[model samples]
Target: MFPKTSLHTLFPTVNFTEITAIDMSVNSDFFREDPLHENLDLAREKITKFQNKYPMSLLANGYLEERAFYNTPNFERTLHGVKEYRNIHLGTDFWLPESTAVHVPFDGTIVIAHDNNYHKDYGPLLVLKHETETAPFYTLYGHLSKESLVISPKGKNVKQGELLAYLGSEEENGHWVSHLHFQFITDLLNETENYNGVAFPSEIEKWKKLCPNPSVLFEEEF
Candidate 1:
């Protein structure tokens, strides 16, 4: 049996969905250098402006396709190693105001909650272990406020729709827009508090099975 979704199906009161809540570009250019290349302040101001222009509090940029931005000089600086890097995003980003209360979608165990303080990365990360109808899956919450991880420890159990964490500010959350990188995964690759949120184009097939599409698809209806 497949795992039943808790983020959208289980909780009716919370009003969370991957649907066109904000039409936050279900297919966003995750590594679009055009946006980040020019004056960052103006770019952020526009993004902040567009954030509230929609009804949904989050933008679900679900499993995206590969685009060529890695070889560029500007993007290359973000690389750490000489090996090939994964650029395609694998998670749904919740673009909302800072300090938003992030609720757990299912009853799960807090496997690991640690602050991944890296520039242009997920600041404070938290991963939960959940047992569904068929198997035990994992959920990752990234770009969280530092305080959220400070109080959250390993081996803690959380219920569905519970106040799990808070959104981090740009300065704190890897210097990006304030949002929650919420993702569901089947295999954890032996990782505890961390997992790859992006994937290589060649590995998309394997990842597709692990990162299933949300029932409520975020599309442009308008």
Candidate 2:
């Protein structure tokens, strides 16, 4: 369950007023031209160009935005004997450079610190279990570098704003551009190492309850 009060005061939150917000949704100008359809290199180039436009500013994509970036077989799924695609993102992505520092947003215990070594996988993933008064929930950090595992190992206790990890390179981060795939999970559905970061558009309402928007913790209104 989510916290009753806003988590913004818990730590210094990012105001999008300072950080630039990039539209990676299907309606965005870049993706509207033509689908990349598994051409991650071109997608990275476009994303890099957007970030370079506003030098030194962090670029972010908000939660629940439907994106076409996951065009590979990795995002395909079967439902009711029919094929469906998982394109609706469940978290907010902060596009950053490789090795960019990522910090914890809350105090929690490291439940998972493992590398999922498959293509389009969360190369270095960390899941932290945060206990609230209502119930225990989890936060997931994906696309982190190898050094993160060494810094925050499983079962380790971490504090708010502590250095959690660094953004992994495209080679290490599921072959996508460097970014932090941050998500909030009310339940892991018995998962350990990783959790579904995207869902089928048809079942979005169901997944939304399981995974709330990570932006609720941000001071900047979404």
Candidate 3:
């Protein structure tokens, strides 16, 4: 079984209280209206501008919109009959610049940390393991700087809230705009350090089977 509890219980220094919630209502004055109805484009533009001005990655660029639950795009069907473009995000994104220090939220062994060009989804990534008395769980840090993995060897144990890696930028981070895509997982499918946390609208049930809400562990209500 997976452990669904506050990461703070394991790492006292991870201060989720300092993290702010991002509001994603379309009715907000900050919401930009687009004639093309390409909300993602408008969102990306606004977030990029905000990121340029803020010291930390501003929430404007990559905040989760509840509409994502229903606004998934449609594309050619895969062999599994799953729409290729309809993956609803199962994790929250933190759009920050490259080299943002990624701290471990809890003590765990580095299970997997590697880079691959397979889909370019998460350019370079790291997955750490955490075990509690009740269950074991894992946390994934995506779009990480190349140097982040260079310093830490696989199987190394990291302390709670310790500096794990720095954030990767758009250039090296799977060609997407800068951000850290973090997710919590219960079962890793017998794979170390690599797992897909995103899911097509049709695969929500499958994703839910593999990945659970990370917010439960973070305990920061959005």
Candidate 4:
């Protein structure tokens, strides 16, 4: 969906060339039958490796991990509540250390900011609504620090690449790795601070229209 739209750089503060892509396919140790991602201890070790390797951030743009992103018991309780379902990831996962600066993708307004804390959930989330003459969309940054809980006025205008928020710790950042769950949204569907970051395989088409592929922002350089 993003290919048709001319999207601008999301983080003007950071150097895009420094960002690196991480492969979570079967080839990687993390994707093996019993991968490191399945356990918190091993996951932390891997995160430390990423922190040392990529100072900018670790990007997991197109990771479809066998339909388990939302299928876990924790995710089911948070998103579905009743139905036990998991969905494939739809946005670029920017893995950064705690307090990493999160910038406004484009000229936009603060639509929503709240703490959506749940294990393996988007703990503290922010939704920035952008409406340019040529481009109109929203950027969702999840797993932000508690400071993001009270970012600013709901309708305040934010410039492109402004210091928007900072990354939160694992305790506040949904018990997963310390990273930003960045998703692009074309429609809010009445969702304010928190929205579905995972999409069931059956609903990928619908979610795609609402959340465009954010990897387009880095495809050229990577």
Candidate 5:
């Protein structure tokens, strides 16, 4: 099992003061219903076209929606056959664009940084490990620029707020609007470079128990 740790103890002075404030009400409507549900056929075609054109990430400011936790549909049916059924978003995502510079939240070691061309989910991604006096944890920075994967070394150390990598566009990242999929994980499950931070509706309970609300760590006005 991976070591347990409190996020607070890891960065005593870190706070969400640096982020821009966001109005959840305004953005909430954007995802009220899965865009894919409106018209699956048209949506898929649009997604394909968007994937081929912009092919880059987007840049914007947004906040983490706590309500999204319990709002996910279904609970048990989605994870039925999977060996690991923890489905639910375990991290807080900041809706933004591609090519955005992703800075290190704090001092940590780069555990895994790679790309997934076939998955079309995470796209270019990076994982950093931070060990606090009380516990150790990892952070996932997903949907990043393909160039971000080119780094110094696998186990290189990064300074606080340092440039880790730039966000990728939709084409390079999994087919979605440009945004940074950030999440905190307690256990990596032997995943050297990447781990699934999002879960199916059925796996929500399991993920909720394993992954806490990241907003607790980054509670800025936005």
Candidate 6:
């Protein structure tokens, strides 16, 4: 079970309604309806173009959206001799400028802060563990600035509304557009440095239960 109240905003003093909601999923009107066929840089350029279109407003992508952009080999997995593709995103993304400060939404202890520096990977990922009346749950912040590691290392206690990390640049944040991939995890599945931010469409039901929609924190449906 999760708490229903007293959560803070990840960003300070920003109006959530003012933020623009964009569909970056497969068959999206914003991006191509089909899977993109290009290199990482080219794919990133497409995101940049969308960002440029909404320069003044914050952009968001909904959780559980099926994205065709993750067509790269990096998203492939060999499971039991069968190839599995993880394209259904499990987290909500906030597209913002580089160096944007990210704050803690609830009182928690930093459980993990590691740099997963592979191409199109989640760079400088941070996981915070929060204790509730029933049990403890975890929150993950991905594509964060490297300085986030020094500021909020593992085993550190953080308060709500406290600065947790800043957004990272493209060169450092997995070579993608600057954005925060925020997710909620009821269980880590024994993962340490990284957690699955996306899942196969067939196994989406399981992942949806493990990583519940984070929109409750924002108090809006993206």
Alpha-carbon runs more than 4 Å astray in model 3: 1-45, 48-76, 79-86, 118-120
> How large an RMSD does model 2 have?
3.2
The residue-by-residue lDDT of candidate 4 on 29-95, one tens digit each, is 5544444255766776766776577765545544443343345655443345546455567667876
List the candidate 4 regions with Cα displacement exceeding 4 Å: 1-16, 25-28, 31-38, 50-58, 63-69, 74-84, 218-222
**lDDT scores for all predictions?**
0.63, 0.78, 0.61, 0.67, 0.57, 0.81
Could you tell me which residue pairs clash in candidate 4?
70-86, 71-86
lDDT string for model 5 (122-209, tens) is 7887888888887778778878888888852468898775677876776788665556777777677788756766665455666666
RMSD of each: 5.1, 3.2, 5.5, 4.4, 8.5, 3.1
**TM-score, every prediction:** 0.75, 0.85, 0.71, 0.78, 0.65, 0.85
* Model 1 worst lDDT run, 10 consecutive residues: 213-222
Model 2 scores worst on lDDT over the 10 consecutive residues at: 7-16
Clashing pairs in 1: 21-56
Candidate maximizing lDDT:
6
By the lDDT metric, which is better: model 1 or model 4? 4
Candidate 2, 44-107: lDDT as tens digits = 7888888668775657675898887666577888778988778898987887678877777778
Report the alpha-carbon TM-score of model 5 versus the true structure.
0.65
Candidate 6 local lDDT, 69-111, one digit each (tens): 6766877777778876789999888877689889888899999
Query: What is residue 189's positional error in candidate 3, in angstroms?
Result: 0.4
Candidate 1 residue-wise lDDT, 1-222, digit = tens: 444444442223335434333322324453344533234465466566765565453444444534342233423433345544466667777566678777776688888788778665688999888886677877788898998886567788888767788888887887766777777678887886577776766677888777755332212221
Name the lDDT value of residue 204 in candidate 4.
73
- Kindly report which residue pairs in candidate 6 clash with one another: none
